[model samples]
Target chain A: MSESAAPGIDTAFPLSPEMRAAIIAHARREAPRECCGIIAGRDGAPVRVYPTTNIAEGNRFYEIDPKELADLEFRELPNENAEIVAIYHSHPASPAYPSRTDVELAFWPEAVYLICSLEDPDKPYIRGFTIRDGQIAEVTLPA
Target chain B: MASESTVQVLIPTPLRRFTDGESRVEVSGATVGDALDALEARFPGIDERVRDDSGQIRRFVNLFVNGQNVRDRDGIATPLSPGDELGIIPAMAGGSAA
Candidate 1:
């Protein structure tokens, strides 16, 4: 499945324990307000997590710092021989699913969107999806 | 009063198809609207994506000039310099289900 990636969603995306922990930690740290970040890595697998500032007002919206995203997209990611494998955001009060806004603003059809849900707080749920155009497909993200 | 001077427009990933995969394009215009008109002339269907039926910028779409929001300036009438950068950012509202 890795050799032949489909046009949109990858079949499987396994997250590392450390990265998962870090993502959850970040979500907890920014509780009540949503946190957003990106995972950069080689090939199709992510190597590191990049936490970015959510410049949008309120908890229901997130606009990544354009300069930071641009630098990573144009310079840093290229220098590391990597691309933004996944973009992650936390759902502070909702389920681990893409909202209407997420579906609408999914610019990268190729990258996986990892949404961490802190609805339960104690039992945080992290799910991954591929959002292409206006359609969404859930992918298996076993950690 | 649009001139032949070229202003760079930063096209986001989703709209690359209209640009033939070019993330950035140079178009001539005196104001934001003129540049967009030039872009629409070059790329047939992009105007509809950027604007609405009333020719107003879609609420979810944000156009930035020189790293500043056009809404904060003069909307489509925002003046442009020869080397100004215009960026298109579709608003990404976050996780909480509403």
Candidate 2:
């Protein structure tokens, strides 16, 4: 009945310090609005942050840079060192929550979907989710 | 005014601190915006958490009512009745250099 009904992909990686920093930095840089990016990793450690532009403009939505995503995938594939483990974005003015469009467009159940909310810009809220067949389940971060 | 059949609103962990750790809350409104407004009124600073200076929904945030995304319905204009559950989820990102 829904697109998320499709099978999920794999996203069992942990957030490295570098990966966490990148996301926090992006959120800060895009203050008053939202910022988005991707994480590539393997063996459960995020290694890189591929920053993507949010083409949604003023709306509360996002569209990844196709060219950048493609390039990142291409570059990572050769080394066999990294794979897309997670996709991330910020909530400039609200709490971090998956929207309806997010569920409908979620094609990767295996990849962690991370969100950062600027509800308290000084201390943003971060979360992870796994969407499968339109069902969303929260994932707890490792302490 | 919201009808008696609208859904319940669930505040995520991050926002729960502001809401006294109450994960799920109940509110009534005919539209999503109305429900949010009601939430803001009940919980101060909540409006600021979800909207920008221009009063628009922030990017990277998603609102789901009854397991359905409000974006697909009508965004702030999405209709609401009693007995529904609303979820507020945030987007996450970041990584260290190798």
Candidate 3:
């Protein structure tokens, strides 16, 4: 009854309607401040979005609460046999490209980094990329 | 003699390649430093990345035991229990654009 990202079957990283709305809404609700969260998946396909609190100091930064991160990575994910396939965040004023800081702080080589840009509040957009070894490859998402 | 105990280490994504893509690994040691040494013995190239030339944790890397930072405790000398979980995370932050 619902559509999701099917890895090999889809050319772009697909966000289910619910997930797409959730992320966009979160970005708007936390407008002028960045938000962080994770998207869990099974078999390399995304299934659910688990939004997390941002612990950083400013609107330009986002940090997942360590305890929250631990809980998802250590407990909930394993219980469902799911892995963190994507790490999503919002950019209050910048474009949705991995910033130098984003690339430097990207530790999960296996997970795609999703950035929602609120630069144009009325016409906000989302983009995904893989940041590994200080390099970024943009991930195309369905328009 | 401190009895050799096996503690679990949670490997971060970047270092998973050295761990054969394993997220968690069990190694035997009486203390955290010993455990890291054991990891190097088993996996090779692990301890060095974790502990630098001076044998201290790298500037941007963090090691947590049971959700607590080792630096807040006793550095590498922190003792391990039978089922302790050690988490490795690289420091993540952003610098204001100039």
List the TM values for chain B, per candidate.
Answer: 0.91, 0.84, 0.91
Interface RMSD for each of the candidates: 4.3, 15.0, 5.7
Error of 2 at A44 (Å): 3.5
User: What lDDT tens digits, residue by residue, belong to model 1 across residues A101-124?
Assistant: 888777666678889999997899
TM-score of chain B of 2: 0.84
- Candidate 1 vs candidate 3: which has greater lDDT? 1
DockQ per candidate, 2 decimals: 0.32, 0.02, 0.35
Report, to 2 decimal places, the DockQ of model 3.
0.35
A15-36 in candidate 2: lDDT tens per residue? Answer: 6666767787898897665677
lDDT of 3 by residue, B1-98 (tens): 77878789887656777888798999888888888898899899977777889998886667788988788899888899888898877544332221
How high is the CA lDDT of each candidate model?
A: 0.79, 0.65, 0.77
Query: Global CA lDDT of candidate 1, please?
Result: 0.79
| Candidate 3 CAPRI level | acceptable
Two-way DockQ contest, 1 vs 3, winner: 3
